[model samples]
Target: MFYICDERGVWPRRQRRPSDCSSQLVRVKLIGEVLAPFFLVAAFEPIGLWFTAPIAFAIYLSFLKHQHRTILYSIYFAFTANLLILYWSGAYVGVLPWVALSLLQTLYFLPIGILARFSNNIPLLISSILVMEEVKARFPFGGFSWTRIAFSQINSPLASIVTIGGVLSLSFATLLLAYLLITKKKSVAYVLLSLSILPSLVSVIQDSSEEKSLRFTAIQGGTPSKGLDFNSRAMGVLNMHLAESYRSVKGDEDLIIWPENAIDIDPLENAIVREKINELIKRTNVPLLGGAVLSEGPTNAAMLFREDGSIGSIYIKRYLTPFGEYIPLRSISEFLSPYAERVDDFEPGQVLKIHSVSGSKVSSIICFEIINDGIVREAARSSGLMVVHTNSATFAGTAEGDQQLAITRLRALEHNREIVSISTTGPSAIITARGEVIKSLKDGEIGSLSGEALILLKISISDYLGGFAPVITLIISLLWALSSMRRKDNN
Candidate 1:
C-alpha cells in the first residue's frame, strides 16, 4: 500500500521480486524456529506464564508448515525446550544424563516435522503430535510425560478441558487453537475459544453435589541436606517427619500422610523405626499413611498404620523412576552418571492398592508416578480422594519441585478429587478438586498442612476416556495419512 521510488522519481510501486519474497519468508521462519522454545519454556515453571503457550505454539507451527529442513528445525526446537524444562533431571547428578535424556525425547518430534512437510491437514498434524506424546510416554523404559504441553496450561482457561478427556484433550485443543491462529482462521478460532470456556462453567455446576469430607494432615519434613545424599541420614529424615507430626497433629484429624522416602530405613526390618511409627499412630489416634522402602522386595511402598497401632493396607509404587530407582542399562548408565552405581534397582509393584480410611477410599501414587497417565487415571476411577507421596530433595534447589507441584494440580482437575501432595523438601500442597491450592508449604520448609478434603466419588469423563484418547488420535492420524496419499495418486 505504499509507493516505491528508486532511481526513477515519482514512479508507481512495483511488486516485490519472487526472490525477495522468498528470502523474507525464510527469515520469518528462522526467527520463529529460534524464539518459540523460549516462550514455551516461559509457559512452564518456574516462570509459569501460561498465556505464552499459545503464542509459542503458533510460531512453532507456522515454521513447520510448508517449511524445508523441517526435521532439523523441529529437533532444534524440541531439544531447546526440553533442555530447559528438564534441567532439574541432572541437577544433582551431572550434565551427561540431562543432555542424553533431552536428546532421546527430541527424537520423537522428527515424525511430526516429516508429516508437516508432506501435508498441511491441521487434524493430521495435531493427531501426530498426540500419538507421539503417547508413544514417548510408554516406550524406552517407561516414557517421561513431564514434557507434555498440557502440563503447562494448568493456570489457563484451557486447563478445564482436561476434565473432559484428561491431558490429551487439552493438548489437542491447544494445538488446534495455535494452528487456527497462524492460519488466520479467526472465525473458527473464536468459536473454539468460546467452547473452551464451557468446561469451566460445567465444572462449577458439578461442584454443587454434596460429598463426604475428611480431616487430613500432610507433613513436609525438610531434608537434612539437598542433593543425592539427602537420604544418606535415613534416621534423620524419619525423625524430622515424626517431630513435625507430633508438633502439628491436633488429635482430631481422620488421616495423616507423609512424603515419599520419609522413612528411608526399612520400617518392617527395623524394629526401632516400626515401633516408633506405631507409637505415633497410637498417640495420634488417627490412621497414618507413610512411604517406606522395604528391604525384603526392595520395593518403594506406602504403608498404612491404623489407629490401633497396626499396619493395614499397603500400596507399592507401580511406576519407579529410571536411573533414580532402577538402572536400565547398568553399564551405559553408570558411565553417564557417577551416582548410578550407588542406585539400587528397586522392584516395581504389579498391583494398585486403594486404602480405606474412615469409610473413604483413598488412592496413593508415589513420586514419578504422577506423570503416568494410565496409572493416575486408573487410580482416580476407583477412589474419592488422591494422595501423592513425593520426595523432591534430590533436585531441591532447582525448579523440579515447582514443576511437579504444577503437574499435581493438573491431576486434581483431571479427576474431580481433592489431593494431598506431600514432598520431603518440598512444595507440598493440599489441592481441591478444582485444582486450587487450599494450603501449601514452601520448598525446604519443615511444616505440616492440615485441611478438610472432600471425598467426591463422582468419576470425571477424563478418568473414563483418558487412556482411549491417544489410541483414537493415532487412528485418526493414520486414516488422514492414507487419504492424503490416495489424493496424491489420483492427481
Candidate 2:
C-alpha cells in the first residue's frame, strides 16, 4: 500500500505479507510473550528454604523495553512474577493477596511503555521511565511503590548513591545503566557500567566497620493465635517480647522496639498496658518504640513511649489497604462512600514525627508506610534512623511475610539508615545502614529476635556525606576520555 524510492530514485509499491505468514508470526510472538513473564517470575530462587532478590530484577527488566507488546508483556510478566513470589511462600491461598497486588501494580508500567513509544531518545526515555513510574506509583490506590529498581541494588554496591540523590537518585541511576546496556556503543557503555558498580564498592567497605552505630533490639511476639482472647493473647505476646528486650538490655543497650499490634489492646483505653510498657522501660532503662492501637475503630497508630512512660510521638498509618482496611462502595467509591471512607477510614497521620531520645533521632513507620519510598526518604532527611513496626498476621504466616521484610532491608541501604523491622509474626530483622541483614528472628516462631542495634555506627560513605552525585558530575571529566574517540571520528 506504500511506495519506496531507492538510491536510484526508482519507486516500487510494497505488498503485504500473506495472511498465513502474518498469522504464523503472531502465534510465535504470543508463545514467546507468555514464556517471558513465566521466566521473569521464577527469577526469585530459593535460598535454603526461602527466596532471594535475583528474580526480582529479572521481572523488572522484562518490563523495561520498548515494543508493540512490551506493555502487555510487562504486565503479564510483572503480575506473574508477583504471583510466583506469593506462591513460593505458601500455596494458592497465600498467593491470593499478591495476585491482586500484581494485577493492580502492572498498571504502574503502562504509562512508562506508552511514553517510550512517543520518543526513542535515550536520556529522555530514562527520565520519562523514572518520573512516570513514580507518578503511576502514586495513582490508582496510593501507588504500590514496592519493588523499586533502587531496591535491587541493596545487596549490591549501587547502594552508595543514596547518600547523593537519596533513593530517588538510585532509581535514576538504575535507568541510566539499563539504557546504556540496551544500546550498542562500547565507550558510552563502559562509562555507564563503571558508574553502576560504584555503590557496591562503597557498601563492602562500610558494612565492615559500622562506624558508630547505636545498639538496639527488636522484638517479635507473633500474631493472635487460635482460640485465644485478644486480652490473654496480648498478655502472652507481651511476656515473650518483654523477655527478649530484657535479655538484650545491658547497661549499654540504647533503644528497644516491638512489632506492630504486639500490644493488642487500644493503649489509650488500657491503663494497665501503658503501665506495663512503662515498667519494661524502667527495667531496661532505654526508650521504647512499637506498634500499639492508640484509638478505637481503626486508629492503627504507632506510639513512641519514652523511658518515663510518657508518649513521645505518634505516627498514624497514612495509607490503608482497600478491602483489607476498609471496603469501598462501588469499586472506586469504596475509598469515598460513607462506606468508601477514604479520608475518614482512619484519621490520617498528617506529619512525619521524629522522636528524639537519649542521643539518636528515630522515626517509627507503621506497616504499609514502608511501601511508600517518599515517606522513608522524608523521614531519613529529618531523622537518623528508620524504625518499621509491622504485623504480618494477615499474610497468614507465609514467605510473603519474608518478602515484605526483605523489601524493607533494601530500604535501609537505599536511605543509608539503620532499620529495625519488627513484625508480629517473626522476621524481626536488624539491618545495618547498608541494607545487610545483621540478625533476624526465625520465621513462623512465637518469639523475639534481639540484637545490638545501637552499636552499628558505620555511617556509610554516602551517609558520611558528599555522595556519588559528585561522581555523576564527572560527566565533564568524561569529556576528556571521549576526546580520543572524537578525534578518530573527526579524522
Candidate 3:
C-alpha cells in the first residue's frame, strides 16, 4: 500500500528495490495495475499501434503509485516514459516539448491511486476505479478523460452494447468482461453477458428505420513540415488544406469535413479567408464543416459554410487544451507554449455544439474533447450524429495515437452515431454506428474519401433518456459491496 506522496514539498523517497516483486501487496498492486491498461491497449491491436504504450503506462503507474516517492517521481516517470519512447524512435520534434506536459498530466492519477487504498477486493477495486474516474472527470481544470476503457471496446462486437449502456455503463460492462475473463467466472457470467448484448439486439430489432446515406467528403491538408516552427507556417498549412480540399471536392459529395484546425484564419476576422470560404462552398455546392479559430488563436473551433450563400453556423470549442491552449502559469506558459502571433488565446465555448448540415444536426467535440466520454454522451443526447475534429500533429510517430482513434470508433457505437473523425495528420474516415472503421486514411496522408453512405440520425434512445441508469447502477453495485464490507467491519 506504500505510494509516492508530497505534501507541498516533502518528497517521499523511492522503494528499496525497483526489481523485487515478492511482496503480496506489491503483487496485488502490480496485477491490478497492469490489468486495466493491458486490456485497454490490447483493444487497439487491430490498428497498427504496438500494445506497449498503454501497457507501459499502466506498469509505470503501478510502481510509481505504490512507491515511497516524490510527486516529482510521478511527473518524471510520466515525462521519461513518453520521452524515452520518442527519443528512442529518433523523433526529434513535437514530443520533446511535451515531456513536461505529460508529467503535469500524471497528477490526475494521484487521487485515483489514493482512492484505490480503500478498495480491498475486486468489486471494490472496480467501483473505486469508476468513482475515481468520475472524480477526475470533474475538477482540476476539467479532468482529462483520455484513455477511457470504453474506447478499447471498439474492435470487439460488444461495441453495439454501448447503444443501451452508454459510456458510464461501459466501465461496468468492460470490467465485468475483464473480471470474468481474467478470473474464469463462467457460472453466473451468462447474466452479465446477456445484459451486455441483449439491449443492443433489441435496439437493432425494434428500430428498423432505414438509414439514409449522405454523400460526404473529408480532407486533411498536411502541415508544411513536421519539424521547425509551426507558428510562422500557419498560412502555409492553411493553403495546403485548401488546396487539398479543392482536389477532394466532388459534385456528388453532400458534406465535406476538415480537421479541427483546418481554417488557418480567425473566423471573426480575415476578409480574404471569409471570401474564399464562401467561394469554396459556392463552387463545391456542398456544405463544408471545417475547423478554425473562432475569436483568435488557441480557441479551436469549427464552422459550417453551407453552399446556400448563408454564413454557416460557427461552433466554438467548449473544451480547450489546458497547457497547450492557454498555459497553466502565465510565467511558465509564456516561456513554454506561447500563443502564436496574431493568436490571443483560445476562447472556450459554453457547451458542446452541433450544427445542421445536409438535413442532419451533427454533434461535435473538438480534438482533446473526444476522449471525454461524458462530453460525448452530452452531445449524443441531442444530436443526429457525433463527430470529432482533431489535430494530432504533435504525437510520437509510433501508432500510439491510433489507440485513441480506436476509442473514437468505440464511442460511435456507444451513442449509435456515425462518428466522422477528421484529424490534421490523418486517420480521417467514416466510422459506422457499430464502432467499426468503414474506411480511413492513415496518418499524414492527403486527399479525401467521399461517398454516399447512409447515416441514421435518431430522435433519442432509451439510454439517452435514462442516462442516470448507468450512474444508478454504479451506485447500487458500490453500495452493495460497501454494505457487505460494513457488515464484515461490524462482524
Candidate 4:
C-alpha cells in the first residue's frame, strides 16, 4: 500500500493526482454550495427556521475550508444568499439596483474567503466574519447590516447571548456552534448550546419587575396602496393615522406612536395638517410621537407633539436609506431607477434625541436606522424604552417587513429593553425585553396595539461593550494571522 502526500495531506498511490482530487471535491459538493443559501434564507424572515442558519453556515464553511477556489465559491454563495434575503429591495425599484446592491455586498465576502484559503483556524474564520460585518456596516453609503447572522438567531437560544455581547457576540456564538458541529464535537456543542440559554433561564427566574410602565398605543394605519406610490396619497395616509388614533385612543394613554411616513405631508408647513395633528393631540390629551417628513431640509423625523400641539424634542433620522430616501451619484442612480430623480436628498441629523414622555425617557430610530448597531445601542443607553417607526409600504407584500420585525426583536433582546415596532401598512408589534412579541398587528392590517410597556433602566452588558467586540475580534484575528504566517515562513 504505497502512499503519497501533497498540499491536501496524504492519500494512496491510486489517488495521488491532487488536481483530480480538487476536481472531485468541486464536483461532489457543488450542489451543497449552491443549496446552502436556501437554508440560510430559510433561517430569516417569512420562512423563519432559525435553527437552519447553523446548518447552512456549516455547509458554506465546509466549502470554504476544503474547496480549491474558495474566493469564487464564496462569491457565488454570498450573491445567492443576498439575492434571496434582499429580494424586497427590488419590489418597487427596478432589478438593476437590486442586483447591483447584492453584487456590491457580495464583494465583502471575498476577504473572508481569501483568509479561509490561507488557514482553517477556527478563531480566524469566526473573527473574519465579524470584521467583514463591521466593515460592510460603515462603508458604501453607511453599510447594510440587515443580513447579519445574529438577526437570524432572534428566536434561537443563542439570542440571549446578545445581552452579554450585542449582535457580534450572538453572531460569534452561532458560528462557533456551526464549527463545533462540523468538527463533530457533540459534547462541547451540547454544552455550549445549553449554556447559551442560561441567560434567558436566569431572566425568567428573576423578579423581572419594571421600575415604571407607560400606557401607549402603536398605530399601524394601512396605506391605500402598496409600492413607491403608496404615499402618493400623502394626505390620505396622514388622515388614516389620525383616524386610527382617534378610534383607538381611550384618553388614558401617555403616548400614541405612529409608523414612519405616517405624516408624509409637512405638518409644520401645512397649516391644515398641523391643526389636524394639534386637534388629535388636544382631543386625546396624549403626547403624540409620530414619523413626519418636514419640508425644511426635507428631513425624515420622529416628532413629539405636546398636548398643546407644540412640537417637542425631534429625532431627525441619523441614518437614511441610501437609494431610497436619498439618491447617491444622481445621474447614475437616475439611470438605474427612473424614480430616483424625484428623490430629494434629506439631511442627516447630527444629534441623538431622546424624548421625555410622561416622566419616562423614550428613544427611537426611524425605519432603516434600526439596523445601525451604534445608533441602536446609543438609543438604548439613553432611554428606558425604545420605539422603532418604519414604513414598509414600499416593500409591502414582501418579506421585508417580516425581516425588519426580526431585526427589531433582536435589538430588543440585545439591550434588554422593550421595543414598540410600528410599521405602516402592517405588522406592528410590541416586543418584550426578552425578544418575545406579546402583541402584534398583521401585515396590511389597519389597527392599533395598546399596551403597558415597561420602562426598563437596567443596561445589558452588550450595551456597554458590544460596539467594541468587532474591533477587538479583528485585531486578534490579524495578530493570529501574522503569527501563523511567521511559523509557515520559519518552516
lDDT digits (tens) for residues 149-204 of candidate 3: 55555544445566665665665566655555434557438857787578666776
Candidate 2 — worst ten consecutive residues by lDDT sum? 43-52
All predictions: root-mean-square deviation over Cα?
A: 4.9, 7.3, 7.2, 3.9
* Top of the candidates by TM-score: 1
What is the Å distance of residue 278 in model 1 from its true position?
1.9
Question: Sorted by TM-score, highest first, which candidate order results?
Answer: 1, 4, 3, 2
lDDT, candidate 2, 175-294, per-residue tens? 555443444458656765666576666667555544355566677766546211233567777666677677656645667778877776777788787788888888877878887765
lDDT of each residue in 287-311, candidate 1, tens digit only: 8999999996799999898998778
Q: What TM-score does each of the candidates earn?
A: 0.91, 0.71, 0.76, 0.91
For model 1, the superposed segments whose C-alpha errors exceed 4 Å read 1-29, 120-122, 201-208, 473-491
Q: Across residues 345-464, which tens digit of lDDT does each residue of candidate 4 receive?
A: 999999999999999999988999999989999999999999999999898889999999999999998888999999988778999988999999998899999999999988886676
Least lDDT summed over 10 consecutive residues: which range in candidate 4?
Answer: 10-19
Taken over the whole model, the C-alpha lDDT of each candidate is 0.84, 0.59, 0.61, 0.84
* CA lDDT, candidate 2, residue 308: 79
C-alpha RMSD between model 2 and the true structure: 7.3
Sort by lDDT, top down from the best = 4, 1, 3, 2
Candidate 3 segments exceeding 4 Å error: 1-119, 181-183, 296-298, 332-344, 351-353, 396-400, 459-470, 483-491
